[model samples]
Target chain A: MSLASLTKDWAATSYGFLDASAKRELRRKMLKAIAVPGCQMPYASREVPMARGWGTGGLQVTLTLVNPASTVKVIDQGADDGVNAASIRRFISRVSGAAETWDTLSASIVQSRHRVPEEVMREDQILVLQVPNPEPLRGVEPNMSIARQMHADADYGKLWLTLYEQIVRKGRIMQGAAYPSMVNGRHVMTPSPIPRWDVPKLNMAKHLTFLSAGREKRLFAVPPFTRVEPLVFSDRPYQVEEHAHLTCRRSGLSGYFMNEIPQDNGGSTFEVSDSNLGIKAIQKAEGAPTEIGETWYRDGEYSA
Target chain B: MLTVAPPDAIELRCNSTFQALMWALSRPGDARVMPEAGLAGIAETLVDLECTVFADTPDLREAVSASGALVTGDVSRADHVFLSSLENAADQIVQLRCGSPLYPDDGATLIVAARHAGQRLRLSGPGIEEPTEISLDAPPAFWAMRAMLCAYPEGFDCFFVDAGSVIGIPRSTKVEVL
Candidate 1:
C-alpha cells in the first residue's frame, strides 16, 4: 500500500550472505531437486565472495541452509584444514553465525569438495557436495539438451558403452572419481567428484546429500534411503579404490580411504583421507578421551 | 575485518520455514512444523519478485502481489499455486505445470490446505527407507487425479499445509491410497 511496504530495511550484508530473493530461488530449486532425486535443477547461481569454481555452489547451499543454530563443516578432499575448506568454513560461520566444527559427527550440515566422511552420517544431517561437472553424459553427449533428452528417456546406452569400453581397454572399471550413478532407480547423476569409496555411502544412507555445481549452474539431490547404483556391467562388478588395506602413517588408522603420498624414491606412503578422523585417532591414542562415532567402513570393509 | 549481518525476523522465519519444507519433501509423509500456520509463511518464504504466483483466495493473491510476484490469473502460467482445499482442486490440478523433463524445476509447487488426519496413504520412494503410512485429508479422487497428471520427471511438487505443520509429497514419491 505504501512505498515503505515494498522494501526491506537495508542491512550491511544480507543474512547468510545471500539476498532474500536468492535464498527464495534456491529454496524453490532445492525443493524440486529433493522432489526428483538425482535430477539436476537449474538455479541462478549467485555471486559470493569466493570464486565460481571454489565450492561456490556448495557454499550457496550451505549459506541458504545455515542459521545461528546450524553446526557447519567444510572439507576439501576429506581434510577440514585444507585452504579451501577452512576458508569456506570460516566464511559460512562469519556470514550466518553458525557453529563450525571439523568433526563430522558434530556437524549438522557438511559441505565438501570431495569425500563423504568416514563416519556414518545420521538421518538428520545434510551433506552438500561441490561438483565440478554435474552432467554424467558430458563425456558422451556434449550437447546438454540432448543429454537431458537422454535422461528423460532413460536412454543410458552411451553410459553403458563408456563402461564397456573401459572394460575392453583397461581390464577394469577405471572411473576413479565422479562415477555415474543411478538414483532412486530413475535418474543417473554424477555423484560429484567423490571417489568410488564414497559413492556407496550415498546409497540408501540415512543422510540427505545435495550435489551442486556453481559454474555449471545446476544442482541435484540424493534423498535419504534412495538407491545410488554405480554404473557397472554385471559381469565386471564395481570396484572401489584399494585403499582399505593401507594404514595412515601419521594416525596409525587403517581400513579407510587413504591419500597416497608419493615418496622421493619411487615408493608411496599412505595417510587417512579424512583429516579429522585421523586427528581423533591420534588424540585417542595419546590417552585423551575422545568420542569416535561408528564409521561407514569397518576393518577395511564397507559393511553399511 | 567485515561484520556479518545478523538475521532479521523475516530472514529467520523464512529460513526456518524453508527448512521445514525441505525436510518435509526430503522425507515424504513426514509432517514438519512450520514457523506459522497456514500458507502465509510459505508464501513469505518462497514467493518474491522473481516468481509467478496463482492463488484461489483473494487474501493469498493479495499477499503474493504484495511480495512483488506476478499474480497470474491462469494456473498454467503460475509457478506457485496456493489453494484453500484439494477437494475442489481438480480444475487447478489439471492446469498446474508439470514442467518438462529437461527442466523439472519449472514444475509448479502446489500448496493446498488439508487436515493432518484423514484417509491413510502408503508412501515409498526416494525419501522413505521403507514404505511409510501417513494420513492426510486429501481425497482418493484427488490422488487419482494426481496420478493421472504426474508423469515422473514431469510433475508438480506438492505441499499439504495444516495449521503449522506441512507434509511434502514430491513427484518421486509413489503414494497408495489405503
Candidate 2:
C-alpha cells in the first residue's frame, strides 16, 4: 500500500475527541467485554482532557459510542445538574455534537457515576457507569495479581467471609453501595457503587451496562438478560436503603430512592435522588404536559 | 464556544459499524444493519496495530495490513480471525484461540460470512431475555465444534455477517441446535 493512501489530512481535533486508533482499541475491548460478561478486560485507557479518576473511563466509552445522532445523558449520584454530571454532559455535547438531555427516557446513552436512573432502561439504551474500582476482590485481597487469580479461580470465599463478618458485627449486611454481585453465574463484579436499590435494576434487565475504571485500566460489561444477583446469605435476604417511605418535599413524589437533607429541628427532609424525575413530577403536578417513563420501583416496592 | 467537529467519512463509517456490531452482540441472535456491506468496515472499526488478525481472503489481509496490524497465517496466533466461508472450518475452529481462564480477553473473535437462513438453532445466555431461535447457513457440525471448544469465558466469540447484516454470538451465549 502507498504511504499516501494510509495518511489523511490534518484536522484540529479528531471527531468525538478520541483519535481513530483509540476508538478502534476501545471497540475491540468492548466486544471482548461483551463476549465474556462481567469479566474485566484491560485496555490502554487513553488520556482524555479530564482527570483519570473523575469519570474518565465512562467518558472514553461514551466518546467512542457518541455520534451526531446520539442523545447523551450524564448523571452523578442520580442528579443530572450536579457539577460533575453537568460538566460531563456539556463536554460530551460540545465535542461530539450529540444532543444533551436530562430526561432518562429520551437518552440513548446514559453515563452515570454511583447511580442508575430510576426509569427502566429500554433494550435500545446503553448505560455506561463510571467506576473508581473495577475489582470486587480489592477489598479482600490487596494484591491485584492475586485478586485476578482469585477471579480466575472464582474464589469468592473471602468476599462471603467479609459479608459474614459484617453480619456478626452489625447484625445486618452493612454494605450500602457497590455491593458485590455475580454476573451470569460466573463473575462477581462491583456494579459501580450504585445503591442496593439500583443493583436490582441490573438483574435480567433489558439494557446493556458497561462498568469502566480508568485509573485501574480495566473495563467490563453486563449484557441485557444477564443474571446479576447480589451476594446474600440464604437465611438473611438483601435489603435496599430505607428511602421508600420518604417523600420529596418539593415535588411531592414518594416511593423512590431519596436524598436526605438534615433539618435545623433535628428532623430530616427528603428529595428524590433522581432530580429529573422529581422535576417531571413537579411539572406534571403543575398541569404541564410531561412524559415520565415507567420506573423500576413503584409504591416503595422493587418492581421491574 | 466550541464548534463541534463533524465526523469525517471514515469516522462516520466506523462509528456506525461499531454501533451495529455492539448492538448485535448485546442482543445475540438479533440482526443489526451496518453502514456498509462486507468485512472491510468491521476491520476498519476494530482491528488496528495492536491486534494480530488472520483473514483467509487476500483482500481482507491487505486491508488488515494497511491498518498496520500483523496479518498472521496462524489462526491460533490471531486475536481476530476472518473467514469468507464457514464450510470445512472445523479444523480452523479447533485452532482458534479460546484464551486462558486467567485472561479470557485473549480469546479470538471469529468472523465468518454466512447466510442468515439455514440450520435452526436456539440461543440462550447473557444477551437473550428469552430463548430465541434463528436460522443460519452453517453446518450443525460447526455448532458442535463451538460447544466443544467454548468453556464459558474461555471460548472464542463469533460474528455471522450476511451482506449488510451481522449477528454476534458471544462465548457467553449458549447455542442449542434444534
lDDT of 2 by residue, A168-275 (tens): 999999999999999999999999999999999999999999999998999999999999999999999999998888999999999999999999999999999999
lDDT of 2 by residue, B1-178 (tens): 8788889999999999999999999999999999999998899999999999999999999988989999999999999999999987787889999999899999999989999998999999888988999999989899899999988879998999999999999999889999
Best by DockQ: 2
Instruction: Give the best candidate by lDDT.
Output: 2
Worst 10 residues of 1 chain A by lDDT: A6-15
Lowest-lDDT window of 10 residues in candidate 2 chain B?
A: B85-94
Count of backbone clashes, every candidate in sequence: 0, 0
C-alpha positional error of residue A243 in candidate 2 after TM-score superposition, expressed in Å: 1.2
Task: In angstroms, give how far residue B20 of model 1 lies from its true place.
Answer: 0.1
Clashing residue pairs in candidate 2, if any? none
Per-model DockQ = 0.88, 0.91
